[model samples]
Target chain A: MILQYLKLLKDKRIVLASSSPRRKEILEKLGWNLMIIPSEFEENLQWESFSHPGDYVVATARGKANEVTKRLEKCGEKPYLVIASDTCVSLETQVFGKPKDRHDAQRMLSLLSGKTHDVISGVSAMLSYDDGWHEIVFYEKTKVHFGRLAPEEISSYIDTGEPMDKAGGYGIQALGGTLIEGIEGDYYNVMGFPLHKFCSTMAPYFGRLVK
Target chain B: MILQYLKLLKDKRIVLASSSPRRKEILEKLGWNLMIIPSEFEENLQWESFSHPGDYVVATARGKANEVTKRLEKCGEKPYLVIASDTCVSLETQVFGKPKDRHDAQRMLSLLSGKTHDVISGVSAMLSYDDGWHEIVFYEKTKVHFGRLAPEEISSYIDTGEPMDKAGGYGIQALGGTLIEGIEGDYYNVMGFPLHKFCSTMAPYFGRLVK
Candidate 1:
């Protein structure tokens, strides 16, 4: 369904501006022979200034995308599209990134236990056109409801070390799927890529961008 | 989280009464040692008499689970649990199963294009206790919206051969993910298993069934 619209870019040089395995896997589903270019952009933005969690991720994502585009142009490799993304778990104004340690993971899970929290992944699709670059930025938020977790359950999950590198201390696609009671939106968004939203957003613009 | 409640059944003789790789993979996430026992139930139920799609699948699933339980007992397997399921795609009164051929797949895809339909999965969890068997039957319905699909898109996807064995003639986890505009319920339900609903339903009864 998606490949038909993207037939124009099937043979184009496409770069992903992040090294997230989940993102790579999601995009790979679109059958893009992606050249991974990890962004050098530092994520030290003051998130409090943003009006919503979506904006914060979009800013970070744009940072990586713009940096990668500049780096590619410097190397005389002008790609058709540079995809960048940033994800964070949020409860109101609080934003949670990858847990620093077991304790941090424990805290994040505890806060999320028996309650609903929002997972937002912001995407920046940078398409280089004839006149100039057309930038498309959007965010997807999935409301995840966690079943009540015992202290032991949290500790045991942390012991597996799955939470150590994942934002908000859980990989929802794996063991974390068990922890979830139900979800309200795109499952891939919680996996760090908003696949449904991304495809719908970028597909219509393919014709103009390709020409 | 689910594994913690399911530790009691970890070593028990558990049987999955279907040979579907998708169902097997989804259930395997709970960390159970499963025995694949394909049921010989002919699926010859009077599906037209059923009031709803859910009831039809539940009837088929129960038939499979009960048949498998009888067969396992005859072979001296004496399974602790036999899980069975049946899935179908429905739009209004219409129900669709696996496509018979490439043309059938094309016809189903065209009917589903630019429209929303229900993916219904019925699950039967049969647990053997001291006195008798505890049987639980439930169904999950997820509304899946497909983007408008062109004839070439349908033909191209049909060439991949993914639609042959999948209900609705599309595998939402693979190339079909692109066809979906959005979904409104458990994503796994569309994948042929209701993981979240299954865990929540079975977890509370684990203690009684184990003893």
Candidate 2:
């Protein structure tokens, strides 16, 4: 399904501007042979600057895509399709990014204990058009609920070191799935991509760019 | 962490009556050197035999475990522990098992489209003791919701032949994850085993049998 869309961009260059292995794996599954250009743009933008969390994530993704696009353009290379994505964990009003330490991870896990939260991932696809660049931004959200965790269970899981690098202090693809009670959105969004949306949105642009 | 518990079962013979590679893979991850004894018992039990889906599943799992246990006894191989599990998909009030054909798979997928349904898995663990055999049975329920799927999308996915062997016409661990909006319950249960319950319930028996 993904390869069909990639076939449309046969001759055009495609760049992925994120260092996430999960995103990279998903893209590879779609058979997109592309260059992995990690974004150098720092993600220290203030969350309060944007009205909605979705906007905040989209803006961050756009920033990363633009950074790679600028680098490519400076090299006298023709514009390519740059894809970047940002994901966050939200519990009601609070937004969680990757945890900084064990304590931070513990805090995130405690807040999510026996409750549901939303995982929102914003994606940005940018291409160099006739004049400058055209960009499209969208967000996908998945609701995940954790079962009540015993302190020992949480502490033991934390000792596994899986929570340190994940948003909301849990990696659902691993031991984190054991803690989950339910979810109401895209499972891939929790894994760092919204594949269905990615495929559907890119379908129309398939033959246009390569031809 | 799982290995720590497995150490307690080191002295006993354990049998897993399943041919599923996925289930064997999960057990291997837990460091269990289990004997694979696939059962030949027919899965023709009527869904209406039990009042609730959970009861029906528990009965089915018990049947599988007992079938294997009786065979082991006759062969003079009295294994200390025998584990069996059964999983099913329930949408609203309708129950679904493995698809009998492509049309059956499509029907199951269509019923689950854009709706939340329960994935119920019943697990049975039997231990042979001095007097006779002690058995424990329990069920785990995970609610899974499918994103609204276009008929064409369903047809395409069905064409992949992934749903034919899965209980719900979908396998959440593969491309089926793309079709799901989210799931509520033990992810392992949806995958066909309830690891947490299996570990916790067997912990006590480990001490008695190994020592």
Best by DockQ: 1
Q: Write the per-residue lDDT of candidate 1 for residues A122-166, one digit (tens) a residue.
A: 999999887767899999998888888889889878876788878
lDDT of every model, 2 decimals = 0.86, 0.78
For each of the candidates, what fraction of the native contacts does it recover? 0.56, 0.30
Error of 2 at A17 (Å): 3.2
| Interface RMSD per candidate (angstroms) | 2.1, 4.1
Q: Which DockQ values do the candidates obtain, in the order shown?
A: 0.55, 0.31
Per-residue CA lDDT of model 1 for B1-211, tens digit only, reads 3556556778888899999999998888777889999999998776688999899999999999999988877887677889999999998778998889998999999999999899999999999877777899999988887889889888878887789999989998787887787777777888899887888788777746545
Give TM-scores for every candidate, taking all chains together and pairing residue i with residue i: 0.91, 0.81
Q: Which residues of candidate 2, in runs, are more than 4 Å off?
A: A1-15, A26-35, A74-81, A127-133, A197-211, B1-15, B25-35, B74-81, B127-132, B195-211
TM-score of 1: 0.91
Tens digits of per-residue lDDT for model 2, A75-166: 97754678999988888888999999999988898899878888888999987677877888899887886777767667877887889888
Q: Write the per-residue lDDT of candidate 2 for residues B88-137, one digit (tens) a residue.
A: 98887789999999999989888888899998888888888888889989
Name model 1 segments beyond 4 Å from true.
Answer: A6-8, A130-133, A208-211, B6-8, B130-132, B208-211
